[model samples]
Target: MPAARGGRWGRLPERRARQLQRQMQAKEERIAELETENAVLHLRLAQRLRLAGTAGTRWREGLPQRTRSLLRLQQAAQRLRQDLRELRAASADLLGSCRDQQQDSLSRILAAVQSAQHHGALPSWRARALRLEQSLQELSARFHRERQRRRRLHNRLVELQGNIRVHCRIRPAMPAAAEPPDPVSHSSSASGDVAHAVDDETVLVRCSRPGHHAVHKTFHFERVYGPAEGQAAVFADVCPLLTSLLDGYNVCIMAYGQTGSGKTHTMLGPRPPGAAQADTGLIPRAAEELFRLLSEDPSERPRVEVSVVEVYNNDIFDLLAEDGCAERPGLRREVLTTREGRKAVSPLTCLPVGSAGELMELVGAGLRLRARRATSVHADSSRSHLVVTVTLTAAASRDGTPEPRSSPSPPQAPSCPSPSPPATGRRPRAPRRASSGSPGAPPESPARPAGQVRARLQLVDLAGSECAAASGARGPALREASFINRSLAALADVLGALAARRDHVPYRNSKLTHLLQDALGGDAKLLVIVCVSPHRQHVAETLQSLGFGARARQVERQGGRGRPAPRGPR
Candidate 1:
C-alpha cells in the first residue's frame, strides 16, 4: 500500500504538467483562429471601400445593408480581439512556468557537473596547470641566462675589436660665420678643401704645393665620417659605447681637433638660436638614452649625477661651482689621487639629475660659465677644455648590496701582456670589474657595497690644438694659447709612449693628460673623435691632428693590442 501511494504522488506533478501543456496548446490555437478572422475582415473592408469609390450612387442603394454588414463585422472583430488578448495572457503565463522549470533543470545539471569536476577531474587539471607554470618559469630563467650570455659576448666582441677607438670627421665647408678667421684681408676666397673622406674608414689629404708635385696622404681610423654624413651618422658609431657604460664600464669620448673644425658642434651640437632640434649633439642624446634605459627597469631606480669642469690656463675650474667671484665665477678645483690610485677632483660640485632635461639644463648652465675667446681660428673658440662627466650609481638592494637587475657584473677586461716591469711612478690601476669564471659562464663577483656598481660617461670637448702665430692673440689670449699648445703637446707625448709600449707613460706631463690617465692608460673604453678642417690653409694642422689620432689608435689599454684600422684603397 505504501509503494502504491508513492507512485501516485510522483504521477501527480506529471499529470498537472500535461494538463497545463494542453491548456497552453488550446490558447495558441484559439489565438491563431482569431488572427485569421481579423485578416479576412480587413480584406473585405478594403473590397467594400473599392466598390464605394467606383459606383458612388449605385452603392448608396445598398448602403443600409452594407452598413449593417459593416457593424456586424466590427462587432466580430472586437470580440475576436478580446479573445486574442485573453489567450495571449494565458500563453505568456504558461511560457513563464516552462522557463522556470527549464531554469531549475539547468541548475541541477550544473550542480552535478561541478560536483563531478571537484571530486574526479580537478586534481588532474590542477597538476597540469602547475606543470605548465613550472615550464614557464624554467623558460624565463633560460631566457635571462641567454640574455646575459649575449651581453657578455657583445662586450667581449667590442673589447677584442679595440678599447680605444679613433674616428676621423672631415668638417664640411660652411658659411663665413663657421670658417676660420683670416687677419690678412677680407678679399680672399674661402679656403680650398684639401681633406676628403675616401670611404668609411679612410681619409685622403691632398697637399698641393705651388711649384712642387702634389702629395696625397691617406690616413686610416676605426671609423671616418664624410661631410655628407649628419650628426646621426657619427652618433650611431658611438651609441654602442653607452651600452658598455651601463654595463659597468668607464667610457670617455673626446673630440680633438683645431679650432673651427666642428669639435664643439659635434659634441654639443650647434649653439642655441640658429640650431635646429634635429642637430642635437652627443651629450643630450646620451643623457636621453641613459634615462630611457633606466625607464625600462623601473624596479631599479638609479641615481645620475653630472659634474662639469673646464681646464683653463692649466687650472681645473668647476663650472658648476658657486664661488662668489663675479670676475671668475668658476671655482678652481684640484685633482687628487685616492689610495686606490684613481684621479679625483675634490670639493667639485656634482648636481643630481632626475631626467634628461634636468641633465641638459645643468650642462647648459655650466657651458654658459665655460671660458671662451674669439681668435683668428674661430669666432667663438672654446678657450678651455670642457669635460662633462655623467656618473650613474646603481640602486641598492634590500640587503644593502648592489641591485642585481641594474648592476650586473661587468665582464672582465682581456688579459693584457705586461711586456716589462713597472716604472718608478706607476699610475693608479683602473677600478676592477667582476671576473667571469669562463667565457660562457655567468660573471662571478664578490659582494660589493651599495652604489659600488658605478660607471662614468665622460664627454670631453678638448680645446683645439692651434698654432700661436696663426691664431693671433695679444696679452691674456696669447698666454691662454701657450698653455693650450703645451697641454696638447703633453697629450701627444703620452699617446706616443703608450703606442711604443714604454714603461713610463707621461700622464703627469700636463694636467690634461693627468686627468685622462684612466681613459688613456687604464681599462676604460676610450673613443677619440679627430675633427679636421677641409680647408687647404689648415693642411698642416689637419695632418698633425691626424697623426695624433693615428698614434692614439695604436695604444691598446690593458691586455690586448690595439686593433688596426681597416686599410682602404690607396
Candidate 2:
C-alpha cells in the first residue's frame, strides 16, 4: 500500500509541474508581443523627430524662401480642408513623403492657417507685398528724374545771371485837385452861362484883382491846364544833387520822360549851334559848373576821365571808340571790381579830358553814335538809352587832405617795357568771323590798367517807354516799342522787389535791370530827374513817373565799410 501511495504523489507532482510550464509559456508569449509593439511605436516616433529636425534646418537656411514654400504648403492644406470630399474620393495614389511626416506637416500647417485667419491677414498680405514692390520701383524712377530736372533748372538760372544795372525813372505828375466841385453845379455853370458871361468875363478879368490868376495858379511838377497861370520849372528838386557832385560824392543824374516831351531839350538843349540866342542845356551848365569849381580850387586840380556808352537792345557800345570796335559781336558781359572795391562792368572805354571844349567834342561824338528813329510823336527820337560817366580819381592823405599824387599822373609805363616793334615777334592770328559776308575785323588795342580808385558822375538819358498806339509806331518801330515796354515792365518788377525787400530779386531777368542795379541800390548818390510836358496830354506819363519816385524813396543800400545804414535818406 505504501508503494502505491508514493506513485500517486509522484504523478500529482508531475501534473502540477506540467501546469506550471504551460503558464510560463503564455506569460513569455505576452511579453514578446509587448516588446514588438513597443519597437514599432519607437521607430515611428524616431522617424517623426528626424523629419521635424530636417524641416527646422530648412526653415533657418533661407527664411524668405522657406517661408514662401511653407506658405504654399499651407495653401495646399487649406484647399484640402475646403474640398475634403474630393480628397477623400480621389483614389489615385497621392505623393506623400511619409505618413507620420504628412501628419506632422499637416498639423503645423493647420495651426498657421488658423492663426492667419484669426488675424485677418491671410488674403491681403500677398496683395500688400505685391503693391509694395511696385511702389518701390516707381519711387526709384521718380528720384532719378527729379535729380535730373533740378540739375537742368540750376544750370539755366546760372546762365541767365549777368552783370548789369537798371533803373526806371517815371515823369512826375501834377498834384490832383484836393476836392472836386459838385457835378451838378459844374454842369450848370458850363451850360447856362454863355455869351453874356463871355463879355462880362473879359471886363471882370481886367477889373478884378490883378494877382487873382497868380494866387489861383498851383505850383506843380505836372501839367494842369485851366484858367490858372504858372511858370514852367525844370529840375528844381534835382539841383541839390547837382551841387553835391562837386562836394566829392559820386552822383548819377538821370532824366526820364516820354517822346515829344522836354527830355531831350532838358538834357541836350533845343538850341542848335550858331543860333542867335544862347540856350544852354543841363549838360552845358554842369560842365560850366565843374570848370568853375576847378578854377576856384587851383590847388585841388582833378583829372577827369569821361566815358559815353549806350545800351541799345541790351547791347553795350562805347561812343568814343570806333564804330566797329564798339560794335564788336559776341562780347560776353563780365563784372569787374574797382580799386575801391566797387563792382562794375569793364566794357566802357574811358578818355581823359582837360577842358569843356573837349567834353563837348566827346558829347557830340556820343550823340552821333546813339540810335535814333522817326515816330509819329517825334521826327528824330532817341531809341536807345545813353549813359555819360565822368570818373574822377583822387589821391588824398589819411586825413582827407589833397596830396601831390592827386594831380593827373602821367600815362602808365607799358607792362612789357615797349618791346622793339616786333623784330621777330609774329603778329597774333586774327579771330575767325562768326559768319560769312561780315565786315573787316579791327586791330586789337592795348589792355587798360586795372585796380584804379575811381569816383564816377553819370548822366543818363533814357528813351521813351511808350505804347504803340500812343507813339503811332509801325513795322520795325512797333517791334522797338514792344521791346521798350517789356524792359520797362522788368524795371517795374525790380522796383517792386526793392520796395518789398525780397531776398532773391530778379535783377538778372533783363539786361536793363542788370545795368541799373548799382545806381538804384549802390554806393553812388542817385538823383532821378523826371521831365514832364506842361500840356494836358502828358498827364498819364507824369503820373507814372511820380509812382516810380515813390517806390525809389524806399530803396535801401549797403553802406560803405560794411557799416550799418545812416540815420538819414540815402
Scored by lDDT, the top model is 1
Model 1 per-residue lDDT at 44? 99
Clashing pairs in 1: 415-559, 416-559
For each candidate in turn, give its C-alpha RMSD to the true structure in angstroms: 23.4, 33.2
lDDT of each prediction vs. the true structure?
0.75, 0.53
lDDT per residue as tens, model 1, 1-570: 999999999999999999999999999999999999999999999999898887897787889999999999999999999999999999999999999999999999999989878777877878988999999999977976885676677678778768999999998877765565544334332446789999989999986756546768999998999988888888888888887776667789999999888999999999763477668888888888888987876645655777888888887766655444433234566677755466767655565667898888878877776778888777788888899988766655556534533333343323232233321111212222222211111011122343345667889999988888888876877888888889999999999999999999888878889888877887678899999988777888999999999999998766423321111110
lDDT of 2 by residue, 391-472 (tens): 6544454554444323333433111111222111111222322211111111111232222233567788877777576667
Candidate 2 residues lying further than 4 Å off, grouped into runs, are: 1-239, 271-278, 324-341, 397-453, 534-539, 556-570
